[model samples]
Target: MKHSICSFVICLLVCTGSLASAQQANPKYDKKLADSLKADAYGMKMYYLVILKTGANTTENKTTTDSLFKGHMQNIGQLAKQGKLVVAGPMKKNDKNYRGIFILNSASMEEAAALLNTDPAIRHKLLDVEIYGWYGSAALPMYLPYHEKVEKNQ
Candidate 1:
């Protein structure tokens, strides 16, 4: 009985040590992947501010304004297809007064600014475009795969 109890304790200690080591070894971001992301960002990242436009004087020219809105969406779709857009949509509820948002990836702010300037929405005065620098972590929330595993186990 004494020997069995000693062996069980030793096994438990070994298992606990191995688990702790494994946990420590796990990292949120992989070094190689992060390096690649940094490289990608060095070339691909450009900051953009999406201006939300609201309908003015809703009482008159509703149809004309609606047609203009459709054209704006088309321009956005074109940009998205060309991989210039990162994120685009309207503002959430309880946010500032803006009809939509767009995140663009370009070589420089000037290039992004130029692109926005050419947009039909801006030309038609349907919306305004604000360009800014985008600076953030390369790793996405979903990139941390270990969190899912930990949650599953729990």
Candidate 2:
């Protein structure tokens, strides 16, 4: 009876130790797997052209536009530092045209729109900004192969 009790206690300790070790091992592998899965799902980054329509001919409106443009330029630098704004620049040669382009990572179109809607430039309405979804070779890894096929066919 004494020998049997001793053996049982030793077996229980061994099993508990193995289970603890297994739990620890699983977290390491699980983290690696989770990271890989996330990369696969959200690897593609998206871009947008923000068209800021300038209001016509009111002194107050023009002044507001000027002030907003200056503030937006400053905010843009901060956004870039935070990894929110990928690239941006004012539109050239036209008073009413896309003011800037923003490239960002988002899970969906809604998410991208939401991010744009939060921009101070959009909120102030000094410029009417439209966010247009951009799909191209630069953003998608699969684009080149598809383009090559089209070119070959042509």
Candidate 3:
């Protein structure tokens, strides 16, 4: 029993030492960019993760639905342009009825909720949202510009 315990302790120590030595620093770290993105020491910051679920109301006619969804897309673009929304996309068919997700750059849940309310789909109950505080890379928005270059569709 004593021999096994000592072996386990030594193995744990070795792994811990290896991890410490393997840790690498970011050579490209930019203080100005970090400050602008409000990044912490680990290059992460807080944002809101919004889960768009199937709402209770699903009775809208096709024409109405089309208009609302179009408005919804417009609202998403507007929010992204305003820098209030960092990410947004729809999900595939699923059992949970999750419709889409949005990563919002808001100071508070209230602010996030208010931003969501602007969406025509959410406003009309075509979609409902579940908001959660999320910690993620502060550089998330930095990829948006690159996405434009790669996206084949306009």
TM-score of 1: 0.54
Give the candidate number with the greatest lDDT.
3
Q: Model 2: residues >4 Å from true position, as ranges?
A: 1-43, 55-66, 136-154
- On residues 1-154, what C-alpha lDDT tens digit does candidate 1 reach at each position? 9999999999999999999886553335466765655435232323465665653434437787777778778877677667566567777655455777777666678878777776656676667655567764444322334444775542
Tens digits of lDDT, candidate 3, 1-154: 9999999999999999999888788899999999999999899999999999998878999999999999999999899889899899999999999999999998899999999999999999999899999999999998888877998986
Q: Ranking by TM-score, best first? A: 3, 1, 2
Ranking by lDDT: 3, 1, 2
Q: Give the local distance difference test score of model 2.
A: 0.57
The runs of at least 3 residues in candidate 1 whose Cα sits more than 4 Å from the true structure, single-residue gaps closed, are 1-46, 55-60, 93-95, 137-154
**C-alpha displacement of 117 in model 1, angstroms?**
2.5
Q: Comparing 1 and 3 by lDDT, which wins?
A: 3
- Which residues of candidate 3, in runs, are more than 4 Å off? 1-26
